[model samples]
Target: MVDGISFAIGRGEFCGILGPNGAGKTTTLKMLVGNAPPSAGKLWVMGFSIPAQARAMRRKIGIVPQSDNLDPDFSVVENLAVYGRYFGLSGREVRARIPELLKLAALEDKADARISQLSGGMKRRLSIVRALINRPELLILDEPTTGLDPQIRQNLWKLLRHLQKEGLTIILTTHYMDEAERLCQRIILMDHGRVLADQSPQALIRDSIESHVLEVHGSDLDHWVGEAPVPERIRCERIGESLFFYGERLDCLVASLDEWNGLNYAYRPANLEDVFLKLTGRELRDG
Candidate 1:
């Protein structure tokens, strides 16, 4: 369902694809990997035409899917060895590569441990390195840190950064705006199967949203607005019990706050999340 979208990932670039649920993010990844073929448009990966040269392209890319698909029955070493065989790697070659891969994933000490015995972070790290067994030039991660705690997510981010520094091109898809901002050199924001904005995180925030946002919360907010009207230069909206103000500068709003008591307010610079909500609307999407 990816509507006629067109963009390219340059060599060695760390790019993020961001969107809400059912924004055709997963569908787009499937097409890129050749699991789903485009009915009309053509695709070329690493200069090889897709769905036709998919077999050849497969060798050049590594994928870490949304969920862990590691073999629970196989030990860490055995799992890596088995996956290497899929790429026609020699038993000796697999043996030689296993130790270094385990070290990179920080699983060298757990080499003999069963998949079920490893912690969630350990398993995720293993999944990332497992994709590298065949030494791919490009890596695609789909919600790589979803459902993990903040500390573990940060650790994974560090690992991904290291890989990119080593010159491997990376493409990531995630619902977390902050993750995309921190890890990706560029972001492609998509919604309803079409690209909405494609730019660096800083550029997107600068171009799409106001310079500042102010949130005022309290039962008195309704009464306060009646007493003192907001300036026409600032945009204002209300959701639930809070009033939000958006503008290049919120000094007038800040100054008015002292006139009212029992009101809680937060004023800060606009961020990628602000841009996302403004462009996509605040209504929730169930799927």
Candidate 2:
């Protein structure tokens, strides 16, 4: 259901697409790989037109799907060999790339293990490496770290950054605001099948939200708006039990915390999540 969304990515860039459920993130990824052809519009990848030169375009890019579809029957190394052949590599050529990919994924010892025996993080790491079997210039990841634990997610984040340093253009879709903010040099925010904002995280935070956020918890916090200091720049919004005050100057706001001594409050810089919630909303989204 995506409508008229367009943007171009340069080589060696790390970009992220952020959105709520049913925002056409997956559909857009599918079209890039030519799995779902665009009904109307020109689609190009690596200097080749999609669906017309899909075969050629695919050769220049790799995809890491949300799910780890590794065959439980195959050993980790065997998986790479099999996928390499899909790119028309000779058996010898595939074998030569195994050591390099395994080293990149830090799976040298686990190479002989059965896919079923690998941990969630290991499996995810393997999926990323499998996508690299073809040595693609561009790597597309769809919610790659959705269910991983924090530690594993951090590891994967480091891995992705390392890959980016190696000069690969990486495009990822993520629901984790911190992930997008930390990993992507640029972010494309989408909702309701359209692009809402496309810019760097810093830029988005600066433009879409105030510089700081003061969060307080209480049952009836809306009545406390007049109690905030320097109320001119502050914009207040209540979500559930917490009331957030956004503004450019927070010194006065921070001092106001003493007035409500018993109630709990925290103040920090505004982030991408704040901007996203401000732009889209704090409501639930059902597909």
| Candidate 1 C-alpha lDDT tens digits along 196-231 | 999999999999989999999986887888876577
**For candidate 2, which ten residues in a row score worst on lDDT?**
219-228
lDDT, candidate 2, 43-155, per-residue tens: 88889998899998898899999999998889999999999999999999999999999998889999899998899999999999999988899999999899999999999
Q: Global lDDT for candidate 1?
A: 0.91
TM-score for all models, in order of appearance: 0.96, 0.96
Candidate 1, 118: how far from true, in Å? 1.3
Score candidate 1 by TM-score against the native. Answer: 0.96
Clash number by candidate, in order? 0, 0
Worst 10 residues of 1 by lDDT: 224-233
User: What pairs collide in candidate 2?
Assistant: none
